[model samples]
Target: MACQREDELQELVDEARKIAYEGKVANYIPALQKQNPEVLSCAITYPNGKCVSAGDINQSFSLQSISKIITLAIVLMDYGVDHVFHKVGMEPTGDPFNSIVKLETSSQAKPLNPMINAGALAVTSMIKGKNAEEKVEYILKFVRKLCNDPDITYCNDVAISEFTTSFLNRSLCYYMKGGGVIHGNVEEIMEVYTKHCAISMNSLHLANVGAVFAMNGVNPVTGERVMPKEVARICKTFMVTCGMYNASGEFAIKIGIPAKSGVSGGIMCSVPGRFGIGIFGPPLNDIGNSHTGMKLLELLQEKYDLSMF
Candidate 1:
């Protein structure tokens, strides 16, 4: 049965790769604009230690907004759930991923959730670092340890490009500061958040990262406990509730797993006690999720019965 499932997963990977040809690479960021839209990769690691991958699994892409989940996890681990919640709420905001109106509306607008830009910046600020560089280094070390890939580094071109075009995010940071939700300098927080987004990794590494969460913070392959069980649970919950921006609701109904998407066309999913999936295709749908990537997850979920709920 395991071998048969592997065959089926391979078939799905092949079919999903073909859809990449129908989409275009994301062009907003100059760095992301150069991605090969036709490139597709899928990697899945089951809880019992089975694994399968196909297509351009070696292709690298920036983490983009996907870094939000990692930063939020680290913050929760370092500060506990209660302390983190005091700065950012867990409710899903029905607005766009980069919406600043929500931040300016009320004194209580504490960034809806950590998956969005506003909330991610807030989470980044809560890392307890003495300075911006310290915070970025801390995040990098945590991410490398989570994936067990020490070679992972920030893409300077991607980071600079995002920083140059992040007027909205900068505005959100200032608004958060005004609300007293973020304590540090606005520039420092934005720099940390943007740099994290700029960190690059391939689908295989991302799959391992997701698998760690799926195994409740333990890297099944290495037997390393990267985070506490409760922190992993909270990260998964946020992924299910707000990972795909406004499209999260539809993704939950269809895929039925805790997942997160980045504007760079990456999707990271976790099926508790089952498997972790990482997929990449650069074209984005209206809601900033990878179009082909979403369809691929739906197909995999239906075929493998991988839905958590």
Candidate 2:
């Protein structure tokens, strides 16, 4: 379905863009530093195949931490909930997404949740593949199916940059490996993890993926099951509890939707069975969430009474 532009949404985007200066684009990745911090865009996809968008919706961005939800879904389907949770806890962490203090202080080395960098690395290690290439292909194939676009692929430059600089992620992997929470070559796991995190897409495609989860694992446009209903439930639960890094609780209290955000200033939200929302605004608050995008969502929630509460 053609996405019909909405003036109302455009107004919201304009309002949110004004706060872009309050935040900064992620610079640690090197590749993400090139983004325009003021750029803001949004797209919403419905079960009836209707879509509405505003702002710079065409600009593509890396998935970053948002890919964690997708990879968690894939691994949950490959391995049962029992096996997956055995490796990563379902609880959220109050510390930073990449912090390793809990990994060393916790009773076990298993990551507290899959949304964090440590847990994401552990989950990536579980993807069923003989090598990094095949594992990436498997993830891409699933992402393509969700977007209904076979051309979807990862950003090679971003992948390489993240792979080379992800010393913290590598350390997380080794810590888990030593604890018997994960097994494999550390470099191979890093290769797959970085590539999946670097998977790039515009706001519209991201909205579509969010819709798949909104409809309980069924692709709204294709009317096909993407994953089992239970898997989708687990993924959504995580999104509610841990998706927005450490700000998830405040987000839940305010916006009240199941959503995930990335360091690249992308937010993918599911309004239960209603619709899927995708937003990109490169400037991030101290918590690493899209500063402007969060404002936009707050505006939406206030305007439409969107809170599921």
Candidate 3:
């Protein structure tokens, strides 16, 4: 079965690769800029513990904003719905993920949604830990569980690059601290946020993590409930509403799946009760999603009628 799936998917990969040169790699992060923009890969993990792949599935990349969805789950479990919602909003923002304009304009001064940069940082601050290291450990442990790979860890180069260069994220943290929207040391929160954003993995590992969410919080391979059903539902809802940054609504109408994208050219997609997809195509479209990766998903959706809507 795996062989057949991979063979069939390879055709899609080849087709998708044709557009690989049409987009650009994320250049702001020095580490990310080192990626070859022409590279594209994909993996899909099914509920039955089967995973199939095409292209260079072994390629590793940071999660970037894709980490936002997982952190939200942790916080939701840590403080429950009421407490989590109070710190961050549930509405989607049409602005770019890093825009701080909404933070200043919102009546409550809270981030409009957890998927955006400001909201993700706010959510990261809510992670339970005595300090930055402990918080990072907790997040890594959870991610390792989700990926079903005990060795999964962050890329130091990427983490350091992001931490040092993320001036806008620091600004968001300081602004929120002043508004009483978030508490604790701003630098500590930034440390935890950047490390998690740098968590590195290949497409197969990412697909396994997405499979857990696709099965509604249960790790199909291990039969462990990593998160409650409610938590998973909320996270998936946010992914549909805000996962693609400002392009999420259009993606929903076109692709119709719950998915999250990272500027590192990684996209984790949960097809719900079916399978999960992980794609890495370093070239990014104008809105920051994987250009070739999006085409691959469109091909899959059209071939298999994968839309939930």
Report the C-alpha lDDT of model 2 over 28-130, residue by residue, as the tens digit: 9999999999899999999976789999999999999999999999999988989999999989989999999899987669889999999999999999899
Scanning candidate 1 in windows of ten residues, the lowest lDDT window is: 1-10
* Stretches of candidate 3 exceeding 4 Å from the true structure: 1-4
Cα-based TM-score, every candidate: 0.95, 0.98, 0.98
Report the Cα RMSD per candidate: 1.7, 1.8, 1.4
Assess the local accuracy of residue 143 in candidate 3 as a C-alpha lDDT between 0 and 100: 97
Q: Which residues of candidate 1, in runs, are more than 4 Å off?
A: 1-7
Evaluate all candidate structures by whole-model CA lDDT and list the values in order. 0.83, 0.92, 0.92
Residue 245 lDDT (model 3)? 93
The local distance difference test score of model 3 is 0.92
Model 3, residue 50: distance off in Å is: 0.7
Task: Show the colliding residue pairs in model 2.
Answer: none
